[model samples]
Target: MESNENILEVENLKINFKTYAGTVKAIRDVSFNLKKGETLAIVGESGSGKTVTTRSIMGLLANNAVVEGGTVMFHDQDVLKMTEKQLQDLRGAKIAQIFQDPMTSLDPTMRIGRQIAEPLMVHKGMSKAKAMAQALDMMKLVGITNAENRINDYPHQFSGGMRQRIVIAIALINYPEILIADEPTTALDVTIQAQILDLMRELQNKISTSIIFITHDLGVVAGMADRVAVMYAGKIVEYGTVDEIFYNPKHPYTWGLLSSMPTLETNGDELPSIPGTPPDLLDPPTGDAFAPRNSYALKIDTEKEPPFFKVSDTHYAATWLLHPDAPKVTPPVQIVARQKQFAEMQKKLAAEKLSHPVEEEEERQ
Candidate 1:
């Protein structure tokens, strides 16, 4: 559930990368608000600007990248306007990131403990001894056993899962207010992925930090996100709560995403995939970015971009299908069925909660 207090707010963020051929419009007029202590998942295919959007927030874009316009407001401070020194101070201290590959993130020559303690030593200005102690504690917190002894081991000495845990430790060493995890579990196996997700959930509850989780996997989004922002062609096509996104998705791109997920009840051998390729960012379409690929796209979609239409108090979608004059179109059959299943499951959970309210309260305690 999202709180009333917003921790970060990004408004009309437009980003472009300079290249030999032309300027690539990576993120165009992207806007979203993240509540404190809530996990917001940015779900989209590769090259959809999910990573770039988060990178903008971290102020970690490449040298050729240009922030055409926008404001990334964190704690009332405009991050885009911050000096290089200020950004340096904020990164890994107030805002930390966990990259996709642990191997690249960890140093091959450095001891794992020292790598984890470096953030503390630099950001918190703690002594070597104290930082080492805190790093060991963080290692244990992230489920790395024998941390005291293992801390001396180099990155090559640990397994992939352990390396990721070390990366998490490094990210959390300073107890950052915002954690950006860019496809953190993509390289791991299913079992390790599940464990990592559970560990993150537990840690988030303990630290009460806001998270911006970037991923292309809808299944992962379903389990982790409190709110979801579905991006397409560098723009957010749909924004809503987890339940709203899963049960009542409004955008065609979102419907395509949900349909592409493999379900237990799926009878077909092959999963349904979205037709057509994404539009080229170098020459972005004048109207809706997704208009070319959208099967349900109206004439207006090709002529003009649609404004965000309010679905509910919190739910919004930027698509012509939401317009009053547009013909009603039902979502895919699989999604409708999934929504019903989710509704039933919610009812059962509610009944259980009602029957054992004290148990629930005690469990929370």
Candidate 2:
């Protein structure tokens, strides 16, 4: 059993899809822990099982999806094994989810407030009038001014950002302990995406809830995550604190991700993307899933699976390069430069903090 400190614990989870084409092994031996009130961002390229891992946690996978092995332990309960009735009861109240597209998740025909109040009324047995009032408050809490008047408006009436705010309002109406946001702002324009991300961070501060954020955007991970889990081909290639993943990445896959981030230095030049497509899940290769694309891949990486070698107390990477006997190789030139840039930024921030002590404290007071 996991503790209250650890809100969610996924252990050796293996999920499969029984499609007409073939049986696809979507999530293989995936394990991670979510601490209370922490944001754990799952970052990877598309089709890397980031969505599938979270969907499994929320009990939202399709009917044809199969749990081949292991467990998703939420508050010491195996969410994967839960019956529909049990999950239905637990979902909105205990584990709320925000999808990539708010327009599709929302009921376009219904009043926004009514939709927001649904979870509160269903889970908490609140009166309709009371829930409606609470729903309006939730909208305001999420930075929506004039929420009371907008309560009767349908989802179609709101802007994309507003619609996502409404979705967030609905997710928080019942005060869930864990919020699984799967690409919550992906579809929005960059400007609106910033607003939504800011809103989410502010809401998280107010509620102090654990958040499992799933995104293909590497940029989003650094700003939002305390820790990050980098997935590739249905397996976690690297798991570590945000600083570790960004500044001192160990895995070749992680290095590739960092090297691919667009910067002013790139100046519209195409960033270094990981070469080769991800492996087909229907027939995953026997060794490291990322071996084929990894420039630093070794003979052993192609013949055997690499264990999670410890990089630090809080960091680990599944790559043969981490082995003591493996030849030491510098990260890609771009990644090294990126790390140096980050270090300088951190030093400047620290100097500023020391030079202007108590300024923020005075503002808070």
Best by TM-score: 1
Q: How many backbone clashes does candidate 1 have?
A: 0
RMSD of each: 2.0, 2.8
Cα lDDT of model 1 by residue, 212-290, tens digit = 9999998998899999999998999999999999998998999999999987788757888899999999999988988
Candidate 2 clashing pairs? none
Candidate 1 ranges with C-alpha deviation above 4 Å: 349-365
Candidate 2: 10-residue stretch with minimal lDDT: 1-10
The digit string of per-residue lDDT tens for model 2 on 172-286 reads: 8887889999999899999989888888888888888889999988888878888999999999989999999989999998888888888667886677788899999999998
lDDT of 2 at 202: 81
**TM-score, per-candidate, Cα-based:** 0.95, 0.94
Error of 2 at 177 (Å): 0.5
- Model 1 deviation from native, Cα RMSD in Å: 2.0
